[model samples]
Target: MKSKKIPERLESKRLLLRKLNHTDAPGLYANIRDKEISRWLSGVPYPYPKDLALKFVLTAIAKFENKKRFTFGITIKGIKKEAVGVISLEKVDYKNKNAMLGYWIGKKYWGKGYMTEAVKEVLSFGFETIGLHRIYANVYSENPASERILRKFGFIFEGVEREKFFKEGEWQDYLTYGLLKKEYSKAM
Candidate 1:
């Protein structure tokens, strides 16, 4: 894991997030293959493959070309700066001053408060740099851990959409939560 001759994109206590690159496909494949990691994830497929990782990286490049939003690979602050997770802003409605936040941590990194810290940093980036008024997150009802993380970040629970998501061969509910710029500022 060589340091990129470039500066780190965003830093948390334990994470030094940076832009996704083609070289990350191997690490993505290795860490993202477990079913547990993909269970609540909307886009990541079960039995994730290396080729799909390459495709995903290409999509990230395309997103950059179109300037949709930013997706970061979360790496720890050390010599081996391999990505331990991902965090992203999507559906950026600049006119409405809002965006959607999403993330997932590798199996080994779960329950260690990594996602919470990453989400906080990304939210700061959203309000301060992206200048967004609102940022929201959607988590499957079965995935209470994500809802807890959002709550810890001061995201208000909006409501649950019944049978709104169809995945893993079954329909499931989704918990929609949101945090406004005021709420974020108050938290800080």
Candidate 2:
């Protein structure tokens, strides 16, 4: 299959999702360093070292360039340089036309509908722009907010994986949600 060029930036009513850059390190560090944020995320370390943010930014850039993953930094309209969160389509499988969706916003920005807006934009890109067949997300069962966002987009609850992740000194169940292109088109 031929590759499609992913856009460097996507815009929503109140948010701008753009490719990660070197200058995003500070903002990424500030938002991701919170223990509350890191606990929900499987990969992020608890302390969330300052330097790791830069490393992550650089790695995201490389992955974007290689078309391996698409990671967008979430920023509000006026303040484009300061990222409040991140949303990504990772583990992209061009042959299968599927990808996994992952996202998180800072504690300060939660409950304001920023993630819901961002997810809508990214799902559009993945299904319509990139021509993906399916997009799925795995959320820890403890995170009802994340599950609600997926439900709003018409993602079906596929199933649950028992003891899928060990975070914060205990095992956690993962609730899988999936949306096919047909489902997205119908909802839209």
Runs in model 1 with CA error above 4 Å?
1-8
Writing each residue's lDDT as its tens digit, candidate 2 over 73-111 gives 999997556777899999989999999999998888889
The local distance difference test score of each candidate is 0.82, 0.91
- lDDT per residue for candidate 1 within 74-126, as digits (tens), equals 88776447776789888888789898998887888788888888998899888
Q: What is the lDDT of candidate 2?
A: 0.91
Give the TM-score (vs. native) of candidate 1: 0.91
List the candidate 2 regions with Cα displacement exceeding 4 Å.
none
Model 1's number of clashes is 0
Highest-TM-score candidate? 2
Error of 1 at 44 (Å): 1.5
**What CA RMSD would you report for each candidate?**
4.7, 1.1
Query: What are the TM-scores, per candidate, against the unseen true structure?
Result: 0.91, 0.97
Error of 1 at 153 (Å): 1.2
lDDT of 1 at 74: 85
